[model samples]
Target: MLEMSNGSQHQTMKLSKNSWILILIFIILLLFFSILFFFRSKPEYVSKVDIALGTTVKVVVSSDKDPGLIIEAILREFHRIDRKFSVTDPKSVISQINKSENPVEVDEETAFVIERSIALARATEGAFDPALGNLITLWGFDRINDSAFKPTIPSDSQIEEALEKSGYENILLENDVVILNNSVKLDLGGIVKGYAIDRGLSIAKEMDPEATGYIDAGRDIGIIGPKFGGEYWAIAVQDPRGDSGEYIDLVYLKKGAIVTSGDYERFFMMDGVRYHHILNPKTGYPIRETISTTVISPDAMDADAFSTAAFVLGSEFSAVLLPVLGGQGLFVDAQNKATYTEGWSFFKEKH
Candidate 1:
């Protein structure tokens, strides 16, 4: 009887070991299925595509979608449309509709930019003007590559000449046709990239309604939709110094554009002082008093234009001016103190 009892206990111990093994296997399988379900329910992702355009263009899109092919097509179309208005020799376009003579015809892309520029100029009361191209070129800010050399300050006479040649009033656009007076020259550099970013986002949205993406064109950026797991796109504000990826702060953005303009971005040092690219339309001198200005708006064009305008307007006026112009802006003075409009706080990410 003692031997039989000992054998029964051994058998029971073996049975208990097998049961535990089975339970462990079942738990592992359950966890696997849970993870699989979670991922399957989540949206698929796509790789980022870098597009080079005026200044620079880099975009990040959904992985499930082909950003490479899509960006290529969009860029091809943009150039094709831009060629009509562009003068290859001068490498610029005339974007005014004149009443005195037959208006120059522009493609859909150029026409759209002209319209946007006109609207922004009117809204800002000449704070953001495409006609500032001559002044930009004079200041050497029109170079395709960001130049590190400081341009000699233009004399008062040169500024006067540039000012005479620069004005939105010199441009005329009617029914998709644009004309420019002899003295007027158009430079869409400030607003065109933002417009293209918007266009790209529009295409991406059409392709996948749920897809989230962002476009970074040098300092101009636009975010569409939310990030994976329904998070906002975190954007880093780069430090103006040459150190790459040195971010001042990370801003959470959704379906909006953030543009920054600063004196430290592209400039050369002369005798221990830095001379940057952004020039004031009024004085034809590099804008001072503010280190940087960032503007966030529903439209990339508005954000781009306003950021530059706020920089030009200086810190004191920008605080009051941006709201009157119907936008939210942030100004960082030379001392690094940040100030923004009342609406700018809503976009800040809480730690």
Candidate 2:
């Protein structure tokens, strides 16, 4: 009887030991799976930041794979480049061009922009000429301060004089050297930001080819790649007369440029009407018939020029001009109607 009792006791002990071992193993597996589940649910963080440009300018950058340090370095370099090319400063390249009798030699980057400007001028039939500096200054658009609105309409004689100096043909670029007529002046403000955005994007791609990035320079924007895990960067077009932060519509872009020109952004009221900065090459007055126009193209310079050109051309002419220039445009007419190119529909969002 004692032997039988001892045998029963040993079996019970063995069964208890086996149960505890199985329980421990199950608990460990449960803990491991819980840890993995927590990690899987957590999202990968990307940096979205607002970078200041000088005291008056500001831009936003969105990146999934790029480090903040890399983005800052790129922007710093851009600002440095801007300072070097700034026409507002008397010591900048423009001053050098004005003072030099011989062709002024510029850095590769500046040379590229000047070349692009020349190409745009030829492409737009002188509609997007960079030699409008004299006219721009005459209109007081060159002033940095938003002082009391100086409403001085240029006389026909003044316009004629400015026109004489306002053609890209007056400036010559040969063998990477730029020579400007003493009367003609250069201002790349309308196109340089877009070009710089492209340059910053190129740098970002070089740093991380697989990384997705975006550059927004107030009016000009460029996308390096899609947002993380997506194939397109969704962008919103701002309403010209609406609240500052409000948008009219969203568009999806993969690899392209978008630029908008709006009269409401910068203008002065005269005799119960507003006068914007865009000057008609012919009339020497702000282009009428459109409140704003936005252009999208494979190149930023094209987009930058086309946006302004479409505004100046009006809906009737832009409808023909945009397609001919190999681009798509969105125009907001004086009646507040929105019209877009046939190609623009491909980039429209599905509600």
Candidate 3:
């Protein structure tokens, strides 16, 4: 009886020991998984700065990928786009198209941009024509390397001659080739930078689809996704008349692009008159209705074209036109009056 009782006790103890071991193993595995989850949930931030498209290109990425690799990739992509679309690069596709009177073959990217540019012109009723290269040069904007480069207003006759050559209808895209009429010179300055931003952002997103970041191509800005903290990025609308670093309004957006066109940035003063770069397609002179215009859209290219159109269309027309195109804008007129589209109110800063 004693032997049997001892045997029973030994077996019970062995079973209890086995249960404790299993529980310990389960706890260790739970700890390992918990640590992994914690690390994966955290965000890592990476940023890069380079000069491309004749301006500063800054990219900020938030992801778990190596920051160095992401930054390097972003910079490389910016330079590639710059080479393909640069108006001044002698070997660029754009430069070749400008020099060639016949239809010139180009890469798919260049062809797509040309098509989109033409479509935007038609959609805005010629308010955002890319064929104003001749007029832009006539106004001496092409010679501008900085504010120090003095500019002279084009003579009335000069403006007329340039306008005669300026028409979006003159550009022809047949198959994968682009043709500029002999009189027309191609300049993608107003839109190419925005397109470059879109392209660079795509590379960063491809590196990590869930990552968030912002690409600042000179004055134009495009956001990839929500911030790491899961909030919209706050972007300030530059005050057209205010000093540098001053802003008139604030915009909050989780994704997409924000671009502003203002008279203050690239204008020349002669005899107390300002001749800015935002020229009207019909008149071949600066549009004076609005001092500044801000556009928010799904991408940088559309935002850029819309901002230019909004500035030319003035406040009243832009308020109506923006909603039709599925975008938004905030326009400040010469009288300091601020007007915004219906969608603007949703992202406008509460103050």
Candidate 4:
């Protein structure tokens, strides 16, 4: 009887040990899945802001990991691209190409930008020309922020001479080589900011495919993925004739880009006349038909180019061009009447 009683107690002890082992395994599996779900279920958002490309650059990133590394990668790329394409920098590749008499070999980015600029110029029939560097210089916009900048309207002959050296046809690119006509210069100031924003957004996406983000490079903003679990981004349009903080419209977008070109952005007033930086290649003067133009497209670079082109072409032409480009636009005329394309109306909220 004593031996039997001892055997029964041993059996109970063994059973208890096996039960505890099973419970431990179950707890381990639960913790493992919980950790996995925490990372995979929802993403966290982090953002960074920096100044580059002569404008404010803001980036918002969503990821499970901290976004410091991603933001640094983006800003580094912006700085590199800015150095390669800046016309103001005498040592930049674009400046080198402009100064060289022979065909100049440039980086891939410069070549691509020049190619795209020329195509857009052709498409707009020279309404947006990047080869107007001479005209821009004659108008004193090239030396922006210069203390010696005396705002003087050039003589008719001077304007004509500057126009002589400016034409989209003067730029030729073969592979990585860019050849410009004599005395012709290239200024990418109008489009580089948008390109940089696109590049930054691409980098953020590469870092984390599931991440959502937006990069705003001054007047241009590039959005990747969706916001706050598939919500659209809100963009406000500046009122051209109103006070500084006044807005004319609001745009909601899930992805793609939005860019604006306005006389209010950069200009000098002399003798009660405004001389803006966006020069019409044909007229050698700022576009006056529209006070501001905004374009939304799948490509930020296209949006940037179109904004300037539409501003030059005015409301009638822009209304037509916007649809052809598979984009939408809002043009503000001198009368403060906002004209929206049919597609643009989709984004506009009803009053």
Candidate 5:
């Protein structure tokens, strides 16, 4: 009688385990279907694209109200920033400051930009430099976008001369006045586009606080809000070695900025050697160690500047540096090896 009772208890336990396994399988299937349904029913968005800030600028938004006005306002803001900050535009304030030998008195906004740039330069120990205008000119990169641009390598002596005339130490600020010494020219190219993104998003938010979409200025994106007002957006990083649309990796984000600095952007090949525009201030030559650096940050200015700084400073240093600056970064070397900060994986979707 005892053996028979034990046999019946074992059968009961086996049946209970089977029942739970079936229930768990059903639950997972339900979740998978639910996700598909949610994505299929995502909210629609409207977008507009125009050329601004020396790159293709696109604005996308989904709001309860019409997004047309908001998009126009944002584009107008980009044009305004471009007008004020374009280093190539002789009429722009930056060009005027670069041309001026005396201390240039600037507005509060310009002063803030200069001060922030100097601060970032110090923070990165001269990795992200605005004082590279002279070096840029020596390489003729200042005219890279022009139709008549001719690619020629600068002599080592010329590079050395430009290096001597350039450094963050050339800048001195005194209560809304900017003084550039040692032939250093202020090129806010590193940080201006990010500032434009931030300002464009702010304009969208001011018009509608719950604006859902993103501002993509030449592929450096700043999220205005969550995708479809709830879901995360899968943002792709471009592969430096691949074609224009080819992607290297992807990171999912609901908010903030994703900015990339790659050697492929503005480059000229010379006798089988590709000469790109991302020059190291320290070496007065193009950086060869890093192929690209992408940064995710709460602010686009930080994202923009740090991406450039990381491209010059190498991937390992950014592992510690970016986190302290409220950023997560991915650094890809010339051999295509990738390095990520500790928090970078958290932004990626789990497989």
Candidate 6:
């Protein structure tokens, strides 16, 4: 009886040990699967950077699929527009138009750009003329960033000659054809950068409407959508005289575009004078009154053109004209005085 009882006890202890082993194995598997599921269900975001349109372009997106593919597609669009409107490329439409003596028939897109440019020039009272290609080339601003470029100052006669060729009236668009008179060389450098940003954003949205991103081309930013999903983007406007990355103000934007045109962006120090890329259509010289102009508009193109116009027209003039043109502006003059439009405070409000 004692031997039988001992055997039965030993069997019961073995079975109990096996049961605990099975339970521990099940717990380990449960934990492993839980961790795997947690990671698999999390959203993946990506960012990419490249050089396009003569600037550093960065695109960031949160996508359900491969984000790299979407970014490459958007970059391809930027290159396409850059190549199409390039002033230096002899094969580009702008170069062809500049070289031809007669009127050239352009695509509808080009015609629209020229027409809108003429209208902007008129509204700014020639402050933002698009027909200043000759002046731009004379100062070597067109190839200012080129490796082989040399800082050049045109003579008074040369400046006058270029100025004579600079006038928006010289350009006439008739039914998708452009007429360039007075030896006017066509250059759209002022607004093409912003247009490229807008194009990149459009491409990103088309590929994935629900995806959120922003395209930052040379610090002129266009929000593809809200940051992450519905967060506002904090954008800083750089101080024109301060060091690189030194900002003077902050603005919060959920959508739309912001552009800044500054004398410090492209300039050559000659005779202790800062001669920048932003030229005055009337004077045929670099604008001296305002050092920088920042514009926030619903459209990047408008912000681009208006910033240039306001930079040339000076701060007080832009204060009145910018609001009328459907944009809020911040202007810093050579004296370091800051000015703002009535609606400029709207950007500061993060609603």
Per-model TM-score, in order, reads 0.77, 0.80, 0.84, 0.84, 0.86, 0.89
TM-score, predicted candidate 4 vs. hidden true structure: 0.84
Top candidate, metric lDDT: 5
> Candidate 6, residues 1-351: lDDT per residue as tens digits?
112347446432334677788889999999999989887765556778888777888888777766788889988888888888989889988998999998899998888888888888888898888899999999998898799999978999999999998899999999998999889887888888888887777877888887787888888888888877888989999988899989899999988899999998888998898899999898888988899999999888889999999999999889999999999999999898899999999898788
- Cα lDDT tens digits, model 2, 1-351, are 112346436432234677889889999999999989887643433444443332222333344454565577667767875776666668877768756777788877678888988888787777777888888878777663446646666788988888777777888887778988757888776677677767777777777676565677774687767666366777788887788878887789877788888998667787888878787876777877889888888877678888877887787788778988888888999888888888788788633
Rank the models by lDDT, top first. 5, 6, 3, 4, 2, 1
Q: Candidate 3 lDDT, tens digit per residue, 1-351?
A: 112346446432234677889889999999999989987654466777889877788888887766567778878888898888766678988788887867788878788999999988888888888888889877777667655666888789998999999888999997988878857877777788788878877887888787787888877999977777488888888888888879888888888899988898678888999889899999999988889999998989999898988999998999999889867999999898889998898887533
Q: Please, what are the lDDT tens digits per residue for candidate 5 over residues 152-254?
A: 9999999999999999899999999999998898888899999999998899899999989999999999999998888898998898888988887888988
Candidate 4 has an lDDT of 0.83
lDDT of 4 by residue, 186-245 (tens): 988777887888888788788877667788777578886777758887789989888876
Q: What's model 6's lDDT at 66?
A: 65
Better structure of 1 and 4 per TM-score: 4
Prediction 3 global C-alpha lDDT:
0.83
**What local lDDT does model 1 show for residue 193?**
66
TM-score of 1: 0.77
Worst 10-residue stretch by lDDT in candidate 5? 1-10
State the local distance difference test value for candidate 2.
0.74
Top candidate (TM-score): 6
Residue 72 of candidate 3: its Cα lDDT? 81
Superposed Cα RMSD, model 3: 8.8
Question: What is the overall TM-score of model 3 with all chains considered together?
Answer: 0.84
lDDT of each: 0.71, 0.74, 0.83, 0.83, 0.90, 0.87
